[model samples]
Target: MRERSVEHEGRPADPDKRTLRLQLLTVRNRLTADDIEEAGAALAGWALKLPELARARTVAAYVSVGSEPATRALLDALHARGVRVLLPALLPDQDLDWGAYAGEGSLTQVRHAGRMTLREPAGDRLGPQAVTGADVVLLPGLAVDAHGMRLGRGGGSYDRVLARLERADAHPALVVLLYDSEVVERLPAQEHDRPVHAVVTPSGVRRFRTG
Candidate 1:
């Protein structure tokens, strides 16, 4: 995509980050239901075989909404294997509080900010610190570059999640789920940004040395 540098006449215009996010969102919105389904199944095939997930006793993952690559199959597969799965519940401050995933029926639709509804766990909230015990953390992102820098939806929620893990000295295998097309050559990075350990796409898994 071309870099957007033009500024609006009357306003202090858009930054490169905002421009990139809009571009990626447009691409994501173009994905069809069938495309998402196929990618989700393929992603499960690649992700389930990873050693990190296979060895994980506790996992932190999320439910995919809208045009994002589906995580329903992968989530179910993890739960079926008796893995302790944790899903995030959005807090008023935009930080995440985790809860145990009981099953498909255990999730409830929670409307947040009057913008989007999230499928969150219906059980008790485990607090934000709960994720510190996870062996692996599956992140939702718009794209991940070769350097494992993830382009999130600009909510800054996961940024806090990563920060919490860091403050706790937790070292879980951080992974991002995306479609093959979302694996890009490069992405803009900020100082607060953290690198992921791997990215699981529809085609395969790409590992990175985050140390």
Candidate 2:
């Protein structure tokens, strides 16, 4: 099948993902606080209905920062269900380490050099490899195409996470969280870019067939 493309403001589609990322970020940065809250609640409602998440014994997720689709509700929901929720803690090298989410109270604000501050789990660190134990991994991305290809911020953190999973032969359900507008028709992909199994938006869920 041919790759699809999403038109921006009736303008021609840009094949360069960097340009697209900037456009998407511009739109996201415009979101109001109320808009973020409503989208977060709706996203949580839709995401919690996913079988992958519902049946998951352990979920690897992140705390949403800035204008990203809010994941606080979903994280708390998973915790309330008695599921083991693992949140990522950024290492000095821009890689991620795992930590258990105890609740909203369990998170601590961490500022990293040359990066946006993050809200990370305050519990003991669980080593980077702990993600291999998750039944589902919720990834943070700027956008996802119809083909499930994700466009992430330049940081190579999740790329490392995916590579580690491959090395360990782990097959967790990989999911991306985004806004409805961020679910586009296509995105430029590199050889190292991994297709996600599904994406959860405020409106609904979209799954792709993956090998």
Candidate 3:
């Protein structure tokens, strides 16, 4: 079946995931522009302090959209640090291609068919395998539990990226950026689910045990 069909399923239609995503998205949608801006700045600051990003030579990340945490600041900061930042360009099949982020001017608004508009790179496509070369991969997620389990937006794009990382034996540090409230007590996980190494929120950073 299609990926959108399982967006709420959270793997086998788990009610826990459905409820958690709904709750998280609702809060995100209600966030005021100022709330999002302030949170984004705070998250950028905390993420910059990460030892992983400081030491990273190549990082794979995505741009934030709508009421999501402000990633533009963080993205600019990383680029200014002379870090090689790779942004994703979604393919037609819901897979992602890689591209270099030069600056705000390098991005173009893309209205994907039957999906939301995304600010993607207006540059060359480096193909999906480019992610294997990254030392760090910043993921976009709704919530993450203590065990590092992430509740994604149900597009299954990141899911495919995770699987690709596994197949390539790419052990880059996986990190999720979120708001303080998104860090919850628990999140249900599945057998195929992979754990993230760290989460950077507006308040602070939290590390988890992952293998």
Instruction: Please report the candidate that would top TM-score against the real structure.
Output: 3
Query: Tell me, what's the RMSD of every candidate?
Result: 5.2, 6.7, 2.5
In candidate 3, what are the lDDT values of residues 1-211, reduced to their tens digit? Answer: 0133345324457777888878888989999999999999999999999999999999999999887899999999999999999999888778889899999999999987877788888999889999999999999989898989888877778888899999998899999999888888788887777899999999999999996
In order, what lDDT does every prediction score?
A: 0.86, 0.85, 0.87
Count residue pairs with overlapping backbones in model 2.
0
Give stretches of model 2 more than 4 Å off.
1-15
Rank list by lDDT: 3, 1, 2
TM-score of each: 0.92, 0.92, 0.94
Clashing pairs in 2: none
Better of 2 and 3 by lDDT: 3
Pairs that clash in candidate 3:
none
Error (Å) of candidate 2 at residue 33 is 0.7
- Candidate 1 residues 50-117, lDDT tens each? 99999999999998988889999999999999999999988876778999997889899988764578
